[model samples]
Target chain A: MTDTPSQLPAHDEASIRVDLQLVADQIKADSRVLDVGCGDGMLLAHLRDTKHVDGRGLELSMARVSSAVREGLAVIQGDLEADLKHYPADAFDYVILSQTLQATHNPKEVLEGLLRLGTHAVVSFPNFGHWKVRLALLLTGRMPSTPTLPESWYDTENIHLCTIKDFLSLVDELGVTIEAGFALDGNGQKRSYKATGWLANLFSEQALFVLRH
Target chain B: MSVLDTSSDNALAPRLTLEGPLVLQSGVSLSPVTIAYQTYGTLNAEKSNAILVCHALTGDQYVAGAHPVSGRDGWWHHVVGPGKVIDTDRYFVIGTNVLGGCMGSTGPKEINPETERPYGLLFPVITIRDMVQAQARLLDQLGIEKLFCVTGGSMGALQTLEWAHRFPERVTAAVPIAGSYRHSAQNIAFDEVGRQAIMADPEWRQGNYLEEGTVPTRGLAVARMAAHITYLSEPALQRKFGRRLQDRENLTYGFDADFQVESYLRHQGSTFVDRFDANSYLYISRAMDYFDLAEENGGNLADAFKDTPVRFCLISISSDWLFPTSESRAIVHALNANAAKVSFVEVESDKGHDAFLLDEPEFHDTLKGFLDGAARTVGLDDGAQGESA
Candidate 1:
């Protein structure tokens, strides 16, 4: 299948975040995948290299989209909030949204749209209910700023930021089955966590969830 | 006005006049059809390295190197040179003047075989398919049975799609950049306005201006000016001219090219009339307006490529309102429905429809990547790559 040696690089999973690597692991080999808000297409490119998956990407930023296309990735410049409705149901085996869930205007609707587009969806987002953030908010009487959520309140893009517990509850409310979940520390190292627990919300800096409707 | 030299000896590009009667899509037959084309690089022994590059409206056969008539760089010199995206160093690139083109090709300006005069309005209206058929004949003459890739942008894109649809066996890969599967009503309206502008001019002489030894310079210029505006986006215009006065501090009250944009449009119009034929403009624009793949295929776009074996790389520009990304999406959807192998990229560019002609790094990279992949699939060995000499 690898006809072009120069393009098909050997597996080098060390470049991306461990959470994304975990998401990549969940994907079956040779399954079609769509990466929403796929900035620079690192995850998609990695999947292509390791799993031989046929991947497509939808990126919001033109510069990122251009960079992704320049890397020979099949990416289109589009808004995930608006463009997600265009994809047919089960058009892809997996629809992965990494670190961009909180930034959406309607994360719930976006989640629903993702599940509609793919058989399974893998989502990762910063957890705002970490103990450090809670402590900082409690002590300073201001919005907490941490390594994972480092943006100032005024200019931050994480509009609908949620805790890991909040996301799990939302999934339960939407009647979607949680296939798997993972937590990552501030340094992008994956940490084991129970699918439904308060410990994840308190300690995890970021959360990864795989959902199926 | 510079007169077109009909003599073949002084032509910059290679010219071929095919024998016999060539039937056009318009149900008209043209005998002794002449096609002017330019070839870059060398044809390999296996002939699997041939790439046919179709040019857009107003573009000529000078795909690389200086154009003899304009004495300027080729329109696509930036993308088609040595070690560039198309890489003239490795592939034998052939660019032809479309059937209804003015640059040394048989168009409205060409002399009629029977009358011994320019065809003018007597020339049958040609379609995009006619242009592709003409190119296919040219390819036959060149002994290239199958093209490694059939690529183009805008009107050229229409030709590229036509090649993939009409001759899937002959094309291994297709690249249609900043183009649509069919011309929209709005696009047809714009072309109509340009055609009306030419016909309204008294100097047009009912398409017989050639006989009168005069050219419809004003009308052609106005048409070119109107059409040129559609090629660029409002943001591009603002970024370039931005209400800036042309060679002056303040704006003139009267409409005498007061702004830089006005002056720019005027320059574009005037310079265009010098090189392009007014009659050829009418014919080509008509052809573009008549392009509708679905209309030809039982009103189902997917039917155009049903069970075809051709890899496609469809590209659209972000700000190209002329043929917006939505249109490209339609093509992608159709290709997907047909289960055809396709890849689509909507490159972010404020340059609008003309982005395909400009030096957009992402666009070039996408083309290079697609060609490289297609080349690998066709088993064409990668040769030593270097800069064009």
Candidate 2:
């Protein structure tokens, strides 16, 4: 028995507004969505209001879950590493893990868990191979602190940091279907489909993949 | 305010009052209580829309209805409202202010019919399990055979865990949020501090402050202020009030609330006193401090769930110093060791103990996904017309 209240830091709510509409477009109208790492429920709120989709989320922060629930979204307070087994197989149409896969102890299992929960799983993360990140790593020989990985190495949540190729290998090894992939600029713009070559691989700031198993 | 049909002669309906005798652990009793409860939607033909929601220590039973005293939205209004998580449109949601709540629930308020005064220190101590027993009696009186879900958090989460253990088949699914079987030493220490703050008050006359028209408001307020700090993280508080001065440009140089944090805490303390009774706070916290679920069943936490059959969606917070992710993992590990149908999630945030009350979008998605899937797996869609609300 949980409900939504307005006790969270207002900064969380403000950051979600920019990505709200695109988040809505990402999920199908009638499909079920399980959003792992849902922050203050901006996307879930959009889904419920614009689409008839049912949304569920798992967040590590009680305050964020508290905010999401206040907005009338169903969310559980949990850590992704130990709790995916509680959900039955093929429970939803889409399982979305965005911007959070990098911070996990085991990103592969989380991705697998997502694929197990939904027919299609959307996984997005910052591409460590981006030219700027690469240049920093190459020049300093220490971890880079881009806008995505803003914290110091010792405190950063980029524990299982990997490149686009590493994620592709994980997908291939898991035998999951690669339904789609997107390359995005630093401005959050989706790049042309033909830009999968050397330039795109080295320059793109973010990577998105839709997988099915 | 709910539509309590005064015209109907339905005496069997549960009455909302601030007076009663609540049975305790040793078969003793406590009197003079207040219970702020809310009933949502309708109980169906079989009369089984009775889902009782238990709340954490700081929570009252303002689930979906406006609180009579707080003038704020119900704590779980988002999850229990129309088309929301609990979905009142399809089910009846019944949450009561637990036995020791300072809300409208009976606490140290009723005049001891013997002394013609409040029960005060005469109130017997209780446990999370004892709280469940009281709720069980209330459910029985309301004609509810089984609950679709027994749900709660922190102290309330302990009760949810106890319900599944005590009345296994009676609960369809249990959702315990940011809770642990045993109150850890750290959490117990915090509770002790709050209790000491109350007892240390000049007005607290050895738990006999009734006749003097003196209430231990200062001590209780300090306790609340301290507890409020634990409920939030350093990051959240820093982001909120920070080191900035409140209402002024610079330090007052005096011992006043020169900092924004002090002012914020002062506000929390003052508001808390207006609604809660000091004595009730002592008793409830003491009960929580004494809770040790594993100790009740040998030394193993898993052994407590060995013979039980309850689906669990146990939740924990990342930054909560009260019941940390490790505690939730311990429960998940035990349930896993017992091979119970359980799912766990550690929502990453700096919100601390109060995370369960905030809006983390992923939490809503996770809960909706888990409950919906559990509903389908548990046959809530078939034959059971009024099991959930």
Candidate 3:
């Protein structure tokens, strides 16, 4: 029933999604972190409980924002595209945009804004070049509906979806420093391939990058 | 001015008369300033658990008890009782009647000691800042070095903002619910209509209705009726009244409260007239119109909260066209610009601006969460026992 993990009442490590747990794992304790499109603040709350990070959130949906704030997480009801500029440069130690990059109206602009908002930016997105997605598209000659891209093209909000290689090229074009990159398997647990390699783009279902500018 | 404190929780007499003139933002001063207030819960030993709740435009000092004038449960009784969302059992809660209010405070209703008459039109126009200043002095008299939180809805929210802005060090957290940093043009226009309704009454006698011993019930009722519509949404009105007729089934063919909505508004107006003063309404309405946080900070709302240490939680109702969610969004943007710790929740409610006063579970949950989060940061131990007074 819940999109993100339900971390309220008490922190349950098992309920947290793999990608969100990965994002939480990278953040340091007591550092200011802003999670863009942080739905229900599961990751923020997790960080607050485990790392004791000073966490904040920006979510577009009022429902999600209310859920986050109802848990005492500092969350604002706003889009990262419009609201990110209001936050001063380096306002946060880390700005996380996980599983929401493709859904943003302008991914490039949002990435730039996120980079400007924090000393480091952690981003994760579903890879459109995964073998299952490519095979489905090639065999059916229709938009792929893999596990990551579950919804039909007409129904999905991932308007700016891109592959791992595409994302790396944009990162290069932006001249941002990539602190680290990972290519996760379809389950979002095993990091077997390097995000910079074409093999990773073709095989992995998701990609994560820790960037700085 | 005599400061009378029967120390009892009676709504009529608990008050504090400041020793000096209260300098106001209008470059005028109010002498013999008396603040009618009520307190609930015990002040902790460290005095760090004090919370100041500023009341709305017509709201009095009775925040969590039977109101003397209305004889009804307090406006915020649903939220501020012991073990409730605000938990009066833990925090020392204080609610004060504003400076330009009729509720035992220094206002047009009170006699002017110098003239031996009601201040009426002679009373200097008070601003939201003036109300906050009076509240600050009240805090000083109570020996509270800093407030754990200052919160309110509507006009009270404006006072909360002024407190956070003017005395950031004195406030650890602030929650401004269903409010804006400044009054919008439409809001000011609605307030003007209310004022004009009061003034148009022959019984008003140009703000001297008190001296004439004639209450401007009709005009004040009309004003309340008009303003009351703004507090509820179109859907709420549609759901509550719609085209449903009151008492009779068919139209009466005259403007004698044929519709249920009309009857409701009329009842709201007449009842408000019984409890409120026309001059105080005018004064408080004018004060809200004059409140502009951005204007005071040289056109940048962010400047008003520059480097402010206070954590803020702003709650806006979805259908509140009076103080729309956009207004709260603007304030949130400004707070974000300063990197100030802030939370903004636009609650889904068709109840409109009055939802803050109503029992909305989301609003209560958001408030409780924010306060709990802030209390943790402020080092207020929930487990500790409050000292008995």
- Give each model's whole-structure lDDT: 0.84, 0.72, 0.87
Candidate 1 or 2, higher lDDT? 1
Fnat per predicted structure, each in turn: 0.21, 0.06, 0.88
Per-candidate total of colliding backbone pairs? 0, 54, 0
lDDT of 1 by residue, B1-389 (tens): 84565544556458887767679997899887889999998778788888899999999899989988888999999899777898878898999999989998889988887898999999999999999999999888878999989998899899999999999999998989889999999999999999999999899999999999888999999999999999999999999999999898887788899899999999999899889999999999999999999999999998999877888888999899999999988987777555455667888789989999999987888788777766765677575232222
TM-scores for all candidates: the values are 0.83, 0.64, 0.95
Q: Which ten residues in a row have the lowest lDDT in candidate 2 chain B?
A: B1-10
Best by TM-score: 3
Superposed by TM-score, candidate 2 places the C-alpha of residue B347 at a distance from the truth, in angstroms, of: 1.4
lDDT score of residue B309 within candidate 3 = 93
Give the least accurate 10-residue stretch of model 3 chain B, judged by summed lDDT. B1-10
What's the DockQ for every one of the candidates? 0.22, 0.06, 0.80
Tens digit of lDDT per residue, candidate 2, span A1-213?
111112222334445432233345567787778777777666776776678677777777776766665454565566677666766678778888777788888787888888887899987777888888999989999889886556788877678878888888888999988877777666666764255665666776777777888
Residue A183 shift from truth in candidate 2, angstroms: 32
What value does the lDDT take at residue B324 in candidate 1?
95
Error of 1 at A177 (Å): 4.1
Residue pairs with clashing backbones, model 3: none
